[model samples]
Target: MTDPVHIVCPHCEAVNRLARERLNDTPVCGKCAKELFVGAPIDVNTARFNKHIERNDIPVLVDFWAEWCGPCKMMAPAYLQAARRLEPRVRLLKVDTEHLQDLAARYNIRSIPTLALFRNGREVARQPGAMDVNGIVSWVDALMRHA
Candidate 1:
């Protein structure tokens, strides 16, 4: 039997086991009938953010931003584009700094737009500033390679 790998369903928050070979392919959740990797940023509140970080076996790239921040607005589309490209390899997540002030404070996020990469529920890298699609992809690729 192949070793089981844990993956959290972005649609329904259900944890499921999948073979390592299936990581690059399309994955469907047994409970929710949704694709496990949808190539979109998943909006997560404080509680759900903690849960996802703790439970997911894949690397998570979280965008910490606010609704009113100009830089955040400018980078939104780029972030989404990067998410679409990086799907199945990295789980993209978004945390609204306005709604989750405590979380923002916990992470010591003083900037309006910050990107943090987490693996195994630990922060491996972070950057502050708005990045274009190419920049985002390059950053993640570099980080993952180094990791």
Candidate 2:
């Protein structure tokens, strides 16, 4: 028998083991009973941010932004829309640069509204500045195809 893939629930932060074959299907958290793969950006602090990036099997797209940036504010809605469209297949995360300065520095993010793509805990690509929904989707799709 194959080992089940474990997924961390964004809602309750519970880890649940799901059959690998059922990954494409809807997965619910055993503890919180919430859908494990929702197409919405999950807010992450410094600690949880590291955990999610390291543990998740799916490709993760993290938006590094600060509240004070105008472009960042303008891009928030577009980011959310992309998240809603790419649920289950891709995981979306947001990191506040103000709260997680260490993380931002580690990634060498010189600008706000930077997007980073990670697979298996390794950063594969990144882009600075805000992107529209279609642009974000295309970039993510290309990243997956390359991976």
Task: Name the top lDDT candidate.
Answer: 1
Looking at candidate 2, what is the lDDT of residue 146? Answer: 81
In the range 33-124, model 2's lDDT, one tens digit per residue, is 98898778999988788878888877889999999999999999999999988776778999999999999999999998999998888999
lDDT of 1: 0.91
Error in Å for residue 69 of model 1: 0.4
- Per-candidate TM-scores read 0.95, 0.92
The lDDT per prediction is 0.91, 0.88
- After aligning candidate 2 to the native by TM-score, how far in Å is the CA of 125 from where it should be? 0.6
Candidate 1 C-alpha lDDT tens digits along 1-147: 467678888878888889878887798997998999888899998878987798888899999999999999999999999999988888899999999999899999989799999999999999999999999999999998988
Candidate 1's TM-score: 0.95
User: For each candidate, C-alpha RMSD in Å?
Assistant: 1.3, 1.7
